[model samples]
Target: MGYTYPVRHQTGTLTTEQLHLLLKNPRLIARQVASLTNEKFLADYLLSGRYDAAGGGVYYETETGDLYTGTDPEAIEPAGDYPLIQLDEGVPSAARTVKFGQGSVITDEKISREGNQYVQKALMRVGNQMVRYVDTVAWGVIASRVSSTSAATSDGVGAWTTAGNVLGHLMTVREARAELATGLDLDTVVLPSAKWAKLVGMLVDDGALPREQGNIALSGTAPVSAFGMTWLTSPHITGTDPWLFDTAQLGGMADEKLLSEEFAAAGQTGVEASTTRISDNDSYLVRGRRVTVPIVTEPQAGVKLTGTGL
Candidate 1:
């Protein structure tokens, strides 16, 4: 009879490849939000990405395109008038930093997990925060600066409750657009969910065809096209006030340069997994500094449908 010796072997050192496999994949909530808002529209008017840490602020400039009135009725070239230029000052907001940690034990337990759910949530929070800021900037531009009063004033509280009022507001937005000498052909309006619902109901009561009511037959989120403008909904805005602005005439700015790293100290991660970690459940940091100023280059390009409960 032969006696067999029982042997067991274990490696204390973790390999780079093995460690990566055990790493949890993180979610990209920030990226998702960016896709929905920032990347989709807000970044278009970026005045500057380079925030001079020493300069303290950035300047945004806007000027109307050349004004050629009838190309000189005398059949001779008239003096070319320079565009009217305006400069806006913008200061970067404080950078938003969020930190999260994956403990050593949890790392192993979650190694088999599909992705970094925790990181995803964190990025989402950061993304949402940035978007909200953007929304704030945009809302301010429209509510405070853009002139809706010229064409229309507040309908009074609960004024948008009626179909006629809704249509009236839409007409004023068009009037606002027409006021621009070289107006951007604005074709979009943003409404709150409640306002959209009310608008749809009113349209239905008016006996308008589905297409006339924005043809919302197929999807609730489907954009409605009426009064020469496509109406969209945004949860960020108030139900009583809708934002009517020109997509062609909006401006936004963001520092696309994302500075991110994981702690090796956590390993690679990002608004994505750029901060994905490797160390014993180490922590990671994602930092983004954004200085955004939504400029109503053409104030006539936007209108705020007011008359709501303050």
Candidate 2:
């Protein structure tokens, strides 16, 4: 078989600095997805754990003291320390890479009529897709863990269309946390868009009152504060089971950071765009990968509000 000479060889023309600049788009994509994934849920509140350490794993010890008693009138015997419950969880790694051909690299039109910009968008899209994939995996892990054990169900009053019902459901979660000896910190609440739409209407009472009183309204995508915890919504999550958990104990862990790489086809040459590669046909190939794992160290730290209806 004989090989034909390509129409353009742009990759060889890119400087090291230019390549690095091209790589920045993938990073931006990663950041955007991170905001939508577990990072947003965990960073501000949950325990980071020890997953960041090389050869990832998290270790924790549970210890308690026993009450001391003695029959002697003035002397009391010392009580021995309770046995420690040591716990450890290994973090698993995940990876992905997406590749596109040359036809997409040179021929497709991007924002600025520049071929390189089109490749940048393509690579960034790969990064975004990777984030969504990992996010779903992480949440699946959480859901599985919750399924293994019983989650505190909501009172069958109704959906959160009323203030009383919303508070009642959250209170039930607080009680469940206490039953597990977990403190009532209630750090975060995540609900599906369906449930969140119902919750936002509950910010203020509809009761008619005189004009002098100031009414508070929540705006934008900011987290809502109720039942002494922050509340948020995720489009990725489905169903009406709202997750109420103490982020200090239950959250996500990563075994590795986001990874990115670009390779030029063999025997290919010319100016390569920032996030592009010259294929055998003189087009570009875009590729990316991400490594992560989901962790739920303490099941009792999370509570899911089960739904009966809307």
Candidate 3:
């Protein structure tokens, strides 16, 4: 005779049946937390260009002293030798591209007890951290390359906080930048959040037009276009100084990989993600990574205004 084991039926203990029912009907509470917005990232607006390779280089042409001199054709006799105009290649430069990332781990036991909530939250947090890191790096690159500096009060104009010719001061800087041979139109201005607040407040209090005051009032901390330039504010810009530059010519970012989650079907180029299982720990490791570098190709294209405020 063959040995046989008894088969279990659905008629289990009352407590076990109730537990199964509860598990099948879970109460809906709320949706996952919203992700952060990218509005505060200056890199998105300042840096330009993209590269697919791991590491690359940039070149800036050296400005000649006679760049502004007229080179119009002059009348010459037949067969007379014409003046020779010389041209040269740009100066080559390179910036280091390094990987940056953040990671989080989810244990199997947690998933078995709860669900995939932990994993989803972990990924969101990791992505946010990557964005912050990139912005910090970009700011550092900009601060380092901008060697030319000036004081906002240099022309006897009081700081922006006081009653002075704020618009005139900005125009003066813009004009100075235009005077450079390699300069582009200074269309962008970056200020710390506090300084920006002070500027708007002063303008509004100083009898600004009703329409302008209303616009400023409604645009709480968002970038506003005024004084013929786009004004941007960021908490990451710790100093009281401001930066004026042409975004197109200031610099660029070498983005080798884009930020993406593991198992995501669509993404290309700065940060990426990977998942791995740790057998010993009985957990899954999720990691986010990015490969990029911020480079200032034309240092002269940007000007840093120091002592802009009291």
Candidate 4:
């Protein structure tokens, strides 16, 4: 015999079966919101990859000796023995994955009055808030690791507001890149939204025409490339200065489980969701969560600009 769902006679009063069915569309909407919000997060760009493990520490290599020393075998004499070099095995470092989540309650009264629109809005808000919370956590880890302690003070270029020497700043970034180990370059620069606007305005005033200028003018927040470095802006990074780093070598994200098995099965990897019906409250509780941690493997791979005067 087929299972029978409870019938609803009163208008706007959803049955148990109808409530679960209504959750489907709202859940999809929530996931969509999360996908859009994820694009604006700097953590996804700064952190290169994901480390999957239930529990334990992660290890990463540290640069010690010159990696570009001798490439040609002909350089070594046939009789001479090859020089033995010791590699620095990375130390074990671990960060416990913390759960970030947000809950939204869909009461029958509200659903009865507001219908599916209310449910969609509530669940979408939950998704955005949960993802934003996780993003803040990831950025917190990155900020703590890539601090301004040893940052380079902007020389020649004064505050960006006064049409500061943009080329001069690029030169400084080039010099910083030259100082890094072989095969590593500071190809990414992150700026605050306000500072990025100043940068765009400065460029426009200077009559400097970049390929991305059109898009920048249209959106006022698009990432642009200059001097072989991708310049990005994020609301999460609030400061007058900028951060330059090698995205490939800096760090990564480690997650015990990005999503529950059910969510993974549904192809939603970063955020997980759960639903529960509250008997006493006559409502359904929907929650979204993320379990992850950002790990800065190479602190030296990036630097925060200290006295940019922006």
Give Cα-based local distance difference scores for all models.
0.44, 0.45, 0.59, 0.61
Candidate 2's residue-wise lDDT over 29-146, tens digit each?
A: 3332223222333222333343532343333332121111212234335874544443332344332222212212433223235544454455445534544455466677667665
Give the TM-scores of the predictions, in the order they appear: 0.57, 0.59, 0.70, 0.76
Tell me the tens digit of each residue's lDDT in model 3 across 56-109.
433333332323434667788999988765554456666667777666776766
Q: By TM-score, how accurate is candidate 4?
A: 0.76
**Worst-scoring 10-residue span by lDDT in model 1:** 1-10
Off by over 4 Å in 2: 1-50, 53-120, 148-159, 204-218, 257-276
- Between candidates 2 and 4, the one scoring higher on TM-score is 4
Q: Sort by lDDT, best first.
A: 4, 3, 2, 1
Provide the clash count, candidate 3: 7
TM-score (C-alpha) between model 1 and the true structure: 0.57
Cα lDDT of model 1 by residue, 15-52, tens digit: 44444443333333223323323332232322112222
lDDT of 4 by residue, 1-310 (tens): 1111111111234455565575654455344444434444456567776676476445444444334543444457768888665455565666677766777888878777777567666755775565467667777777787653333343556544433355566557657556655456767777787888777777777766465554456555446665566777767665567777877777776656544433431122355666666889888777776666778876666777766656
**By TM-score, is 1 or 4 better?**
4
| lDDT at residue 24 of model 3 (Cα atoms) | 28
Q: Pick the candidate with the highest TM-score.
A: 4
Give lDDT: candidate 3, residue 30: 7
